[model samples]
Target: MLKIKKKFGIDELVNLTSILAILFLAAAVVLPHVRAFRYFALIPWLRGIGLGGLFVFLILQAWIHRKKVSELFGHRRARSGANSALQIVLFLGLLVVLNSIAAGHRGRLDLTSGRDFSLAEQTKKIVKNLKTDVLVTSYFKETNPSSMRARELWKEYSYLSPRLKYRQVDPDKDRARAIQAGVKRYGVSVIEAEGRKVEIEGTSEGEFTGGIIKATRGEQKVVLFLEGHGEASPNSQDQENGGGLSTAKEAIEKQNYRVEPLSLIAHPQVPASASLLVVAGPKKALLKEEVSAIASFVERGGKVLLLLSPQVKTGLEQWLKSYGITPDDNLVLDYKQHYFVDASAPLINRYPFHSITQNLPDSFFPAARSLSADRKMPEGVSAAPLLETSDSSWGETNLLSRNLEYNEGQDKKGPLTLAYAVDVEKKEKRQKTRLVLFGNARFASDGAFTAVGNGDLFLASLNWLAEDEDLIAIPPKPPGPQPLVFSNGQMMQVFYAVMSLPAFLLFFGGLVWWKRRRS
Candidate 1:
């Protein structure tokens, strides 16, 4: 080692000092203009300074020993440079691979285990049919989890189509811009496309996507409220006194649908724009011409919503037979103890397993009647039950008489069908015509509109009729109470015991066994 030190020279020190000075000058001149490079310049400056100082110390040590500087570091300089270059290349390669994977999979990877991908099909359909550029600006509160979820969902939208642009706007930070854009709620998405805009409130990506589809789709949907048969009318005195037509009309209008009153007898032809015809609780029977016109409308791919009551006449029942839907004259009576409200009264409590009622709560039905499928079902028509009475229910055949008490064998035992949805295929055009025949229309009346999922059921049926069932809003789960208060000390103790007892036992037992073994 002493013989090697004798070969180190003074010229190496001068070269190292020159390199350090040049690196410092480059860092000082370039760092101020380039933000990214400023951070990187520090690394080279520190290396130059550190290596330069070491070289100077080595030269001093060599001078004290009367040795040449080249003998000390000449052989190691080339190896050190090669090793550092290789390490830097390895780091850069790793960084590029990791960044590429992250960019490709960022939005696709969901950290939320409970995320739903069921609406991906519908989302894809909208994306593939995009005619023009669409911008989705999401307004969210910075601290809200729903805001984060909305961003994640928007990322999926962007991933699906390059035409769609997703932007996040914080209402708190960008107050003036948010106000000008008319964002009322946190986590609301405003979709703008083709000179049109739609504001979608709530935190549902499915609903927001549906709103975009509806806004872009040029055809206007018209929901006709059937009148002139003592049916509830949107502008009628009956609604002012407590009818459902006005409420239902308002709800439908909010969804960008036009509402109109149509009397088949008054104007025999169903309007071309009519997507759905609602016959809500008609007290009178339809005339022959009216019945024929409705049948023609159905044959021409028009949707019909027939909401019947126990008061429906015989002529209407015979007319409904053309579509294979038979509304029973008998009123349903539930004997189940678990049924909501008075079980003895004509109230429906249980709903059948169908799209409309699948996830609905146990809905209450006031004065509900029974419906059945006739053997006269049209060819290629599919029927599904929407609502039914429990097995403990009986349909009182003599609807005129209000006698509740009856022998077990005297009454028809359920599950009795109360509402049936039929999708009839048109022979001429091969288009599916939807018909919903409900035994009790009063469930949708103003009197019982809010009875559990009554309004939701009505909305779902209308959407189904229009072949826009995916637009129906799924009711959000009720939020649990926050900062749950323990009412009593005993309750608090019980809660702690239930939550921590097993963990405490396991931990203490393990600790005791470890301590004993060590002892």
Candidate 2:
């Protein structure tokens, strides 16, 4: 054994002891306060213990060698630059690891992009009251951009609730599973609950999420076309060489509404699930029993969309009177705002300010009837005008004769009421029954449907009546048509005068100068 002297200074021992004590206190108290430091304390404690044992071992080695403690520990000069760089690298590494753990390796935490916040309240109601487990499997392949968009949407649904699980199945890799899951196409989200599955085909999160909401709480809207009169059927031909409502039936059906011809003569009892009853351009009168049934239906929270034509010869007018709606026997003719080739075809353009026609463009109404509300509405019933003729308009009493003579004093002046919506409050329930009366049904005819939002107005009215406004289908954005572009003459003029003329002059001038210089 060699006898050695301890050279460790009192100041060094004090400094080391103080640092160890502070670190221990920080681990005991501060580590619990900070979530990040709690795990760090574990590793630091093991390293400190091992390092402390090593320090004692080094001290023993120093004692044996009888040398300075500084010599055993190496140089004491601080390299600030190197220390800062090492600290920065360690901090960045720790931060990356911690973030990965927190995010569950699910990519960047993007809280900004999501479904409409306004829909959150509605979605909460749907999710909270869901009776069955809804398994939403998004069968999306990475090849398509829509699939990526669908995944992002599914992430929103998952964030809403843990009950909603999203499983990503690659159609190509998992062909067998995809076939079993009934995934016919890529970018398809399948929502299944209570043994019922609805495959909604769309890439838009709003559309896909809306479909899910509809799937959960969708009500079937049925539109009954009052037949037995000369009203147009779904298969009716356009006899007048003008547009017919036959094409509208297909459009309505596409909105998940079942359009069935309801001949009150054959079936007197109105279907209980009838969301709306449509009386379209009837040539004959409604039977007494049919009128009573309609009135009773109106009294019992039912919805009606009445479209009266100038050719209506029915007592349906009287039945409508009981509900405080009176259709005058005259065709609405607007002299100020009309769309027509000649005096025979009168086109009324102005519409009233109502939700149905609020955003609609200027429309052409051909041979529309005039309507008016009684001075007093029935008890608990509310009425609002939808469309009215301009101050220059007049009611043509002799509409069938096709005589284009306007009697100013005889006809009702401008602001002739053309359409109205009546809400009849049911005494039994707090809810009210809706009735929309339009002067003309032919506006929804196939030929005129696309003429300046006429079809949109008709669809909107029907939606309002059925109380299915949210389910109203937005018309698909038309594919890019031939963009109104510059004509050939304009293109040639631009090429020659603006572009080619200047370039040609510059080229010839440069060539002449080059030839002169060379000569």
Query: Judged by lDDT against the true structure, how good is candidate 1?
Result: 0.67
**Deviation from native of the Cα of residue 117 in model 1, angstroms:** 17
Query: Residue 221's C-alpha lDDT in candidate 2?
Result: 74
Please give the CA lDDT of all the candidate structures.
0.67, 0.66
Clashing pairs in 1: 6-68, 7-68, 7-71, 8-68, 8-69, 8-70, 9-68, 9-69, 9-70
Q: Mind giving the per-residue lDDT tens digits that candidate 1 earns over 56-109?
A: 655566565554444544568865876787699679757755654454444455
Per-residue lDDT of 208 in model 1: 63
In candidate 2, how many Å is residue 185 off? 4.9
The clash count of every prediction, one per candidate, is: 9, 2
lDDT per residue for candidate 2 within 1-519, as digits (tens), equals 999987887546655655675566455455433422324325445445434544554555556565554453464444455467669967975775565355433333436433122233334444545554567777777787877777776776655554565667888998998899877888777877666677877755444554565455556578888887787666675846443577677657645577887877876778888888988777788888998888777766778888877757777777777668888878776544565332212344456656666545555567787888888877777789877666666777865565656776776666677788887775755657888998887777776665555666787788788886554433432223312223233455666778877899999999999999999
Task: In candidate 2, list every pair of residues with a backbone clash.
Answer: 285-314, 391-414
| Top of the candidates by TM-score | 2
Error of 2 at 362 (Å): 3.5
